[model samples]
Target: DQQVKQNSPSLSVQEGRISILNCDYTNSMFDYFLWYKKYPAEGPTFLISISSIKDKNEDGRFTVFLNKSAKHLSLHIVPSQPGDSAVYFCAASRTMEYGNKLVFGAGTILRVKS
Candidate 1:
């Protein structure tokens, strides 16, 4: 079962604090990992991604680290802001698949208070 799982259903943080989200997977076939942030009704937008070939990937305020050996990964946001408050979804897929189909976790809702 290549299912992605986010154990935490929600997280809350101060405006200038760090926000860390965790994820786990059981499928050994998943070689690519991604994080997406979503607002109320809009679709999720790709935030960051790491290939199984690499251990880490970062983009601006977001960073993703993949530990394939343990089937774990995390997304970190430094100095989290109110704008960063949203549902975060961890997704995985085989990088070399014919078409990229993402399997997403239930999602973690982040709340940032000023």
Candidate 2:
């Protein structure tokens, strides 16, 4: 079974609107959550992240929320622009003896229309 899941395969939004992407996890050992955005033919770029200790974290137009109790997280983008369109992946990681190991959910494609 996958530890992390993104039920929605895709999302679409109008310019200047808000885009919400949801994720769920089955692992309670995960302490860090991250969101990454990827353009076609390129690697994913880190977007926003939230620790289990905090409920939310925001940076400019991007925000990430974590609900530790529910094992859920979401990414919100305000004033979505066409350039914001990309595949978003949610990743969870836990610190191990060697290093941090990450588990990524299937990406959700976001299409921001003009």
Model 2, range 16-60, lDDT digits (tens) per residue? 999999999998988899999999999999998888899999999
lDDT of 1 by residue, 50-112 (tens): 989999898888889999999999999998999999999999998676347889999999999
Which candidate number has the best TM-score?
A: 2
In model 1, what are the clashing residue pairs, if there are any?
none
Estimate every model's Cα lDDT from 0 to 1. 0.92, 0.94
Highest lDDT against the true fold, candidate: 2
Give the runs in model 2 whose Cα sits over 4 Å from its true position. Answer: 96-98
RMSD of each: 1.2, 1.0
Error of 1 at 61 (Å): 0.9
